[model samples]
Target chain A: MPYRPFDGQNCSIAGALAIIGERWSLLVMREVLLGRRRFQEIKRNTGIASNILADRLQTLVDHGVLERRRYSDQPEAYEYVPTRRGLDVNPVLIALMQWGDRHLAANGPPRVPVHTVCGHDAEPRLVCSHCSQPIKAEELRVRPGPGANEAQRAEPLLPAD
Target chain B: MPYRPFDGQNCSIAGALAIIGERWSLLVMREVLLGRRRFQEIKRNTGIASNILADRLQTLVDHGVLERRRYSDQPEAYEYVPTRRGLDVNPVLIALMQWGDRHLAANGPPRVPVHTVCGHDAEPRLVCSHCSQPIKAEELRVRPGPGANEAQRAEPLLPAD
Candidate 1:
């Protein structure tokens, strides 16, 4: 029912999904990042079946997103912590939250990120890597790159600006 | 098996999984935005099972991320296009790609996102809302907002910034 192969679509989007695209993998990352470190804590917060949770955690560890470390020698408990790889998923989670808050939300955002450095609401903005300008949704366009396919190279792929 | 509910840890992240957190939903959005409009094209690009693809497509349409339109009257062919809500997901995909490229890539990224405006490898940076400065990962934190629960408000929940 899960772990379906992503199409080797010769694209990074598909490439990323191929790694983390499981049933509860991203949610597991969410829980761990949100300070739900223990197995039972994560399971209780997510209502995920124990088998599925264990499986997802194992896969994430195998892929280097999480590190499995024992907390206590007496009780022999384990906690899931984000490696650099896992911590990098914050932007992805922010993106998802912004999208859900925009559409599916009935009230308002359930939680808001604070940019501790700037001391303000950390509204994730898409800033251009080169120009360092904040990219509004209308300010983007897609052009073929070196990795572009035949059709892509011939005709540029522009989604919504 | 499929519709697992995340109980409530950081409900924003949990709630995020409630929508785009499914297996193929984000990939489906990727294909649609990347100019794969037809059913067969999306299925081919995603490698998702037909039934699962159809179900995801239906859910996306129901949620208004995508709109289905008849492209031809003869055979009545349809195409999927991202609404504003759907295009909003590009940052999420880009962020995931950045993550996968950084940690998971064995040699190099399978593909890269080019900022068409500047024509360089575009790493979409998250900036602070108040000032337009880049928000570094380690320099961000969060506090309870108008939406914080009693438990969330009772304690200081500082996730890794």
Candidate 2:
């Protein structure tokens, strides 16, 4: 399968961006996640042009992020719903939202994520799954993993000074 | 003070995307975050053209995500470093990397984040700060916050049925 030019870096960040890194792509996902499923609804909410929206929708569906289902037959309307893969983007969206809320929002966070199970204003915290302790950005380092290519493996340890 | 068209929507995810949503923008950040500080080094690592790299670097500096500093007076060489604001993007990059590793990687993750303090491989898990329990995408919902626009305020509480 052909990959984006940048995907040659053997980096997962680049690999992910090759799929949903476009501004409009994630915005489309936001709409569906927020309950706007119809084409017109997504188009209006995103203010994205019809042709572009159509293309993005097709690509998303092709990539298994969204599933197009027939919602009505009279005029043959359809709704796009997130698949498990699409739902997996929640963390990325939350991270982006939290960053914007912290740095961009003048008044406050525009929307806050609530943990429905716990019933409290929930801010997502990244924790070490093994230790269950909060993980700070400066306190983490990257190392070559099983999939690392030869060049990637040869790179120096991260946070090089 | 100019903002993206979607900024008016008052959504933090959209707000953040307005800043770093472009494919190349985040990729450029990844390179810098991984210690590729020089212009030529970033360009080579990201495979981005010189013009595009220059444009991204300028934008990142303009937005306060990166700072440009002179490294050599004789040669007029400079290095780009991530500002505090830019370093805050670690969670976003980690989220993207994790997603790509889980769903897109053919072998396994090329790089793994290790918690420096714990000395163990760290997979960031989203936890509810209030409860300190891991939260999954299916377990979260969004609600209007102080910054919500009137229109957003009026929208049915999120995850609306």
Candidate 3:
């Protein structure tokens, strides 16, 4: 499929989606983040065709989310490792997993995130960085920021409902 | 493109992606979550084709993420409203937005999320719900949960790196 870039949107979500929004792209990142860094391992876990996986990995590398490093000298083998930008995607992955566990998982979540700090199963929650209060969808509002273009600024900023 | 369902993965992330993993689906959700409920408004903002927008909205409604309600009587105008499931997608959207703001936004965040509770520009962070410590990608681990099948359980759970 041809990639569609959200060039004019001027929204950060759209900007991020332009990079990692594809279905397979995020799944590939899931594998890398889970420590399955080799080509075959990610391919095995995702069941993605080799060509497609290669393409996704290249795009991720081009975007600086993952980096390739030689792991085996004799075989010329390389491993894909997450950069800081890639590791930052953890929250998005966790958010999606929690959503699935709540709505789609009939039996239960097949995988659970463990917070090594407190030694317990981690239920990650989105909280305000300044106030430390849990963020609710209705309580959040949007406004034009420094990066907002003229078109974006003209749009209604407050929650309409 | 044909939608490829990640059957047999038995992973919540994959399950979630099977629904909203499509590139346009999440963008559509971003629009709805931002209070752009009407068809024309969404189309205008996302620049998505009308047919594709219609298809995505129908899929979201079918999945219980959104509902159609009559907003006008004479012209039979209707609006899309987020259900609980839809509202739950806010975190994912916020996470994506923050990622873009950090990495892609050249100027700054095009839009800022305001925490209504504290009346400050909200920088949402994912923290352990139990300990309230901020989550770091390197400090987290995954394990097979109650819903894990034998295959998932057999895969190495620890972070290899």
Residue-wise C-alpha lDDT for candidate 2, range B67-107, written one tens digit per residue: 99998998889999888788888899998998899889999
User: Where does candidate 3 stray beyond 4 Å?
Assistant: none
Per-residue alpha-carbon lDDT of model 2 for A1-161, expressed as tens digits? 12468657788899888887778999998888888899999998888889989999998899998999999999999999988888888888999998899899999987889888889999889999778889887777788999999988998568753
The TM-score of candidate 3 is 0.95
Question: Which run of 10 residues does model 2 chain B get worst, by summed lDDT?
Answer: B1-10
Worst 10-residue lDDT window, candidate 3 chain A: A1-10
lDDT order, best first, reads 3, 2, 1
Mark the regions of model 2 whose C-alpha exceeds 4 Å error after superposition.
A1-3, B1-4
- Range of the 10 consecutive residues with the lowest summed lDDT in candidate 1 chain A: A1-10
Compared with the true structure, model 1 gives a TM-score of 0.87
TM-score of chain A of each: 0.86, 0.93, 0.92
Model 1, residue A31: distance off in Å is 1.8
Task: Provide the interface RMSD of candidate 3 in angstroms, 1 decimal place.
Answer: 1.5
